[model samples]
Target: MKIKSLSLAIISATALLSGAVQAYETGDIIVRGGLASVNPDVDSGNIYAGGVEQADQRVDVNNDTQMGLSLTYMVQDNIGIELLAATPFSHNLQGKGGLAGLNDFAEVKHLPPTLTVQYYPMDNSSAFQPYVGVGLNYTIFFSEKFINGADATFGSLELDDSLGLAAQVGFDYEIAENWSLNAAVWYMDIDTTGTFKNANGTGDYKIDVSLDPWVYMAGVAYRF
Candidate 1:
């Protein structure tokens, strides 16, 4: 009888340890929140005047940060569908090249919604899980303001919306049975055409700007 009791105790102990190591599982819902930064690597073209190129005139944009949220639904132990969202980000625009020393020439607000399919390489029993993802990003721009207290210098600012491909690599390290720390980086393709009329009334000027941004996030995740 004592031998049988000892055997039962060993089985119970093994089961407890096994359960402790399980991080994420099928049908689990994970939510993460923290700060996210968007750093644009802008490739801007020269300004055009009524379809004619104007040399030495270009646009430059600066970065912004806001609250970031991520939601994940586990389809399998190793696979998940994730959505990334954030508050509207505001970016400051400036001039480059011959247009240098131009600060806060314009400002705009945008929101990017991204959907991704992530593959976690580790099993459910591992506390550290790294993932790679492929996704799509759509950005909408609004509330464009041409500052410098000289609204008459430039007419309405128009920035075209963007739809592009995105890729990400990230990791989650389990700190508790239902909590983890997450760090992620994403690269998105964002291109836009900005057009505004010159106050001097030299027709409308257009610029083809590629704002391919790298996004970084670090936060705590809760699994439910």
Candidate 2:
């Protein structure tokens, strides 16, 4: 009877210690926020010549900075889901050449909300966590402004609403118990249509533009 009692006590103690270790290993909720920069390659096609030519027009977009916040829930040690929110980014557009020279520079707004499924393959003992996510983006354009020295206002430039696909890959390295350093890169494919009308309304033109942007971000994350 004494041996049996000792054995049971040992088993109970071992189970409690095991449970404590597991509780420490699994994180229930994580919150991380950071800043990102948007670098977009803007390309447009002319529809008038029956053949699509990559326009020689050079349009420069101002480098813009944006902030993002995300919440993650760990379903298991290796898998999670994250919802991303960020501030709206505004861009100025300018071009030169052909009829392009006739159009003035304009400003537009783009907002992208992303949700991704994350996978952490090395969650057991390593401080590095790598993840990948795929999501949808809806871009809204507003508050249009035309550059000075141009003949037309933004009203003369036509742009349609867009829905796009987004994908990202990033990683986080835990620097401390509550802080982690992170870096990520994302790709977004967005398409739009713009109509340019002459000031006299005599000549109307249409343009198809693709603004596929690549985003790079590096910042610190805090877990609560």
In terms of lDDT, the best-performing candidate is 1
Give the distance in Å from residue 80's predicted Cα in candidate 1 to where it truly belongs.
1.0
Q: Over the stretch 1-224, how does candidate 2's per-residue lDDT look in tens digits? A: 99999999999998775443331135667777789788877776654323334465445456578887777777777777777666888887756455456443677777766667777766444667778878776777766555565445324665687888888898888777657888888888878876655565555556677888887777877666
lDDT of all predictions: 0.90, 0.69
**Global Cα lDDT for candidate 1:** 0.90
lDDT (Cα, tens digit) per residue for candidate 1, span 90-162: 9988889877877668889999999999999898888888999999999999998788864668876789999
Q: How far off is model 2, as Cα RMSD?
A: 6.2
Q: Candidate 2, which ten residues in sequence have the lowest lDDT sum?
A: 17-26
The TM-score of predicted model 2 comes to 0.73
Q: Which has the greatest TM-score? A: 1
Give the count of colliding residue pairs in each prediction.
0, 0
Misplaced by over 4 Å in model 2 are 1-27, 47-60, 96-104, 151-158, 196-203
Query: What does the lDDT read for residue 222 in candidate 1?
Result: 90
Candidate 2 positional error at 216, Å: 1.0
Model 2 alpha-carbon miss at residue 161, Å: 2.6
